[model samples]
Target chain A: MGTKAFWLATTAAVLIVFAASRLVTNDYVFFAGYVVLQYVVLATAWNILGGYAGYINFGTSGFVGIGAYSTVVLHKLVGPPIPVLILVGGIVSGAIGLGMGYLTLRLRGVYFGIATLAMAIVVQTLVTNWDFVGGSRGVYIIRPAHVPFIGGYIQYLFLVMLVLAAVAVAAARTIERSVFGFGLAAIRDDEQAAEVSGVPTLRLKLIAISVSCGLMGMAGAPLPYYVTYLDPASAFNLGYTANTIAMPLIGGTASWVGPVIGAIGLATIQQVSTVTISSALNLLIVGVLLLICVVVAPNGIVGLVRGKRRRAGRGG
Target chain B: MADDLLSVDKLGKRFGGFVALDGIDLTVRAGERLGLIGPNGSGKSTLVNCLSGTLRNDSGTVRFDGNLLNGLAAHRRTRLGLARSFQLPKPFRSLTVVENLRVPLYYSVNARPGAPHLAEAAVGERCRELLRLVGLEAKADRQPQDLTQIEMRKLELARALAAEPKLLIADEAMAGLSNSEVDNILALLMRLGDRGIAVILIEHIMRAVISFSQRLVVLVAGRKIADGDPHAVVRDPEVVRAYLGE
Candidate 1:
């Protein structure tokens, strides 16, 4: 599909989903749905760098922390609208992403992953020490009871996250088809070969990281309002990093749809299990599913499906 | 020297105590088919690496098409029209054979100064043309793993050519191929050279090298020992000794 049509379709689909979601009278549904939608954004964001560029970034929480903290800082200072907060959050985290890539892209392989993990730790430590945005003590956000059109603040956050998810998916799909995306894919395959083939590997990597982190930050921007209690521990949670990485791997990293599918499927399962089976089983569930994906379908669900289709075609 | 397409003066590279390339001097004319032959650990690959900006040379200058490529990145050098195929085929394993060629076309060729932005159709056309040139049109959609060794070599060459390079350094492109496949790659290289693209074919296969190169430069122990007519370079005593271990 053309880029324009794809975006239009995506926007339409998101509106439909949002409109349908509003019909549910239960506020808890919005609360759970918001988390699932947030993953859709985070996983898609992570895939841009990790899956597409083959640079595993263990700094999802770091970027998210930056975004959430940016909102908190802005909320304390100017008290900007949530949209402005999201934009500012994206910019701050994207710049950090670019800076991180500059410092560590040369490391290659697991070293780059280590550098990102270290960056997350560093960011978390900074957040913990900074008292302005509530350091180790944590801070409370008093969100307005109801938004004008959305009725409830949680519903507004849900609507914002849904839109962000669509945007993230659309952006991913656009990059996947562009020349820039092709260059990124080349770097993922073979860095030296990509370089000699005229791919600006370092530059592409920086752009990938920046975009990935920017979107991640956008996902995190709403968290301060969602939880109403923001702390370094929760904002910089390792759970965000793990889920961001796992979603793409479980769904398939080769295409943009993989992360969306992985995020929706995995997040929904986690959400459902957290309610039905105890919240303690969340990590255990993620672990067992990830293990299954790694063993039974190393390439993830998309790869597994593709393999089956190929085999069936051959057989027929 | 100014008229030469590529000129290297006193290029040196040392990996700690071991000297990989020591003050190597070489020049190639535009569209020149220059075969670079060297024994194992003789620094032919090292020289290629320096020229292509894969590794930084510790000393000396490399002037390619009037630009002094001292600290330029590999992609920058490629954008300046220098390209190379890997000794082992490094086709983007995830990409199909044709898509592998698209990478260079997108980044290198289209990125050139004053180059028109190629339409999507044009890019696809260019990829197909390259596939046809390398005789991989039949396997354009096939993954790199599915290709035979020779097909992989062809894909590698096609990928390099997609950059529309002024100079293509083919590093052992014909290695491990059958004799007919060697000739096949040799013919392909010769065809590229005829299209006004200078080629530096680094190969262990003497027959293919001799038949393909108008000039042969031999490297022994990180130094040039013989450089001149292909036949004479093969017969050079030092080159013979370097190969046969006299």
Candidate 2:
């Protein structure tokens, strides 16, 4: 789609979602919708570094957990507004991401991935020991009955997540179209070749990681308010890491639309299956779907569709 | 000496006590076509790597356009008008043929100082022109995987050319091509040289090297055995003994 049409379609989609949320009286839909939107943000964020640059970052939970804990600390210390807390969370995660990139981005392939995984463990340990943000025991967050402008607290949280998701998708789309995107694609194809082609690979990778981690943190900042509780275990949940990585991989890792499609599809399936079968089966479902996608459609749904169209064009 | 586009002095590299390039000195004047011929494991690739900043020398200086390039990274060197085509074609597999050229043009050429900023249309136009120069204009939209052996080599050269480099080191660019393909690549290298870009053609194909090179340098056992006119260098006793032992 053209840039103007894309924005028009996105704005219309956001409005439709907002209007639809107003018509529904049940709080369950908003709560479920919040989870899906949050995944959209996480998946898109991860795709920036992982999909575009071909740097597998296994530390989604670390950045998200940092954002969640940032919100908790801020809420306890000064009780800033949620938006302010989100911004603080993003800055904190972005800084950490930048530091991590500087230190570990020199390692390529699996070693770099292993470093990110280690980062998650280290963050989890630190959060576990810290008593201010509720240590291992966790802390309860008292929520007001309603937010001022938005009637219900859940509705307000859902709206925030929806906006964040839209912004992440838009940003990813912009990066995919820019010179920066081409550079990232070159890095993904071959880093040595990209460097020889005069691409500043290190700078681009740092930018990608910073943006990606910042978005993840932003998505996590409001989680304390959504869940009405926070702890190291829930905040640094492996589910966040698994789902964020799996969504983009299963949806398609190449484009902005891939993560969105993957997140919505996978999140809906998980939500439905959690209710129908058992909550324990959620991770199982994700694992199975990931495997199936890797084997059957390695390029994800978008790639599959494109491949079909190309084949049909040739045949005709 | 100051007019030399690339001057390497006392360049040395070692891999865990095994000397790869030892105390090598070389120079190429602006727009010169210098062929570098060496036996397998004779450190030709290593020398190219050092000159292109892909590998760092243990000692010595690589002065490119009179600037010291010892610690500079490969991409930095590329931005400063130095480029190389890999021995194996490393085209961006996901991008189309034209898009492959766009990477270097967008990054290297556009990044050059005092160069006019290229618009999207101008960039596209340059990409087509590069494809035509390499005789791959008809396959502009094709992927690298779809390219034939010669076409892949052409794309490799085209990618290096996109940098608008003052110096290009082509590492075995015509390795597996047929006779006509070898001549085709030699002609392309000559065309590039005519445009005032110094070229270091590292090849084992003596016929192509002899026909293309204005000067030839021979490396054997990580040491320069001969450096002079192509015919004189080939006829050197040391060069012949290194190649075909009597």
Candidate 3:
């Protein structure tokens, strides 16, 4: 599709969803929808570096926590609007991503993954110790009585998340089609080959990590107001890491649609199962789904569909 | 010497205490076809790596097209017109054959100043032209995984050429190919020479090297044993004893 057409379609789809969602009187749906949309942003962000560049970042919580705490710190200090906090959170997390990439990006494969994991633990510990943002004691955020136009604060949060998800998806699609995306794909295939082929691998990787972390942070920026309580444990929850990584892997990693499909599908399932079954089953489901995806459909759903289509074409 | 496209002086590289390359010096003029032959583990690949900025030299200097490449990263060295194919074909498996060519063309060739900025359609046209040059136009849409061994090598060469290098290093590009396939690669290299792009053909196949090289250099045990006309270099007592000796 042409760029203009793609944007228009995306905008229309988001607006349609927003308008439809308003008809629901149950605030529970909005709360659940907000969580799903948040995963959409997180999964899409993770895939930019992990899927495209083949640099698996295991520190999703680190970036997300940075964003969440950036909001807390900003809200406590300046009492800025949520939009402003989101932007600040993104910049702060992106800067950290850039710094981490510069320091440890030289390590490849498992080593790089280990470094990122270590960084997450370090960030969590630092935040847990600092009392200014409540540290381990946790901080409470007071939501406004009513959101302008949106009515309820939860509904407003859901609307904002919906917009963020659309923006993330659009950004990913643009990168996928651009020359930069090709560079990242080359890096994914072979770093040495990419370098010799005149790709500035280091530069491309730094950009990928920065953008990925930035998006993750933006997704977490509104969490303070949504949850009303912010603590290191909740901010750096392993659930964010697990869900974000699993969603992309289960849906597909190579395309923009994959993470969205994975997030919405898995999040919906989790929400439904949580009410009917057990919350503990969520991790088990994600783990089993990840294993199945890896073994049966290594390229995820999109790849599986393409593979089957190719097979059918050949058979015919 | 001033016009030499690549000049290496006192190059030295060591892994631990074992020296892979020891105080080597070589030069290739613009459009000069030079053959670098050596026994197995004689540091031929090491020299290529050092020159291409893949590996840093312990002690020495490499100047490419008047630019010092000592600390330059491999990609920057490529941007400065130094390009090399790997000993093994390293095509991007996720990309089609044509897309493989586009990576280098988009990043290295079109990225250079004064090179025409190709539109998206022009990029496709240029990719097709590259595939045709390497005679892989019919397999443009094929993934590297689907290609034959020889076809992968051709794609590797095509990828290196996509950078529009002033100096192209083909590191064992014809290895494991059938006799006819070797000739095909040789002919391709000769065509590249005709275009005034200097090539370093590193091979153990003497017949191909002798036919393709204007000058031949032999390395044995991390030291240059012979450097002169191809026929004379092959006949040199030290080169014959160190390399040809079974």
Task: For residues B1-246, write the lDDT of model 1, one tens digit per residue.
Answer: 668999999999999999998889999999999999988899999999999999999999999999999999999999999999999889899998889988988898889999898888999999989888889889988889999888888888899899999999999998899988888888888898889999999999988888889999999999988889999977878878887455
Query: What TM-score goes with each of the models?
Result: 0.97, 0.99, 0.98
What C-alpha lDDT do the candidate models reach, one value each?
0.92, 0.93, 0.93
Q: Candidates sorted by DockQ, descending order? A: 1, 3, 2
**Where does candidate 2 stray beyond 4 Å?**
none
TM-score of chain B of each: 0.97, 0.98, 0.98
Better of 2 and 3 by DockQ: 3
What would the per-residue lDDT of candidate 2 be over residues A203-314, giving only the tens digit for each residue? 9999999999999999999999999888888999989999999999999999999999999999999998878898899999999999999999999998999889999989
* Candidate 3: tens digits of C-alpha lDDT, residues A64-148: 9999999999998989988999999999999999999999899999999999989988999999999999989999999897877
Indicate whether candidate 1 or candidate 2 has the larger lDDT: 2
Candidate 1 chain B: 10-residue stretch with minimal lDDT = B237-246
Q: Worst 10-residue stretch by lDDT in candidate 2 chain B?
A: B237-246
Give the per-residue lDDT of model 3 (tens digit) for B42-90.
9999999999888999998999999999999999889889999999998
- Per-residue lDDT over A25-99 for candidate 1, one digit per residue giving the tens place of the 0 to 100 score: 999999999999999999999999888899999999999999999999999999888999999999999999999
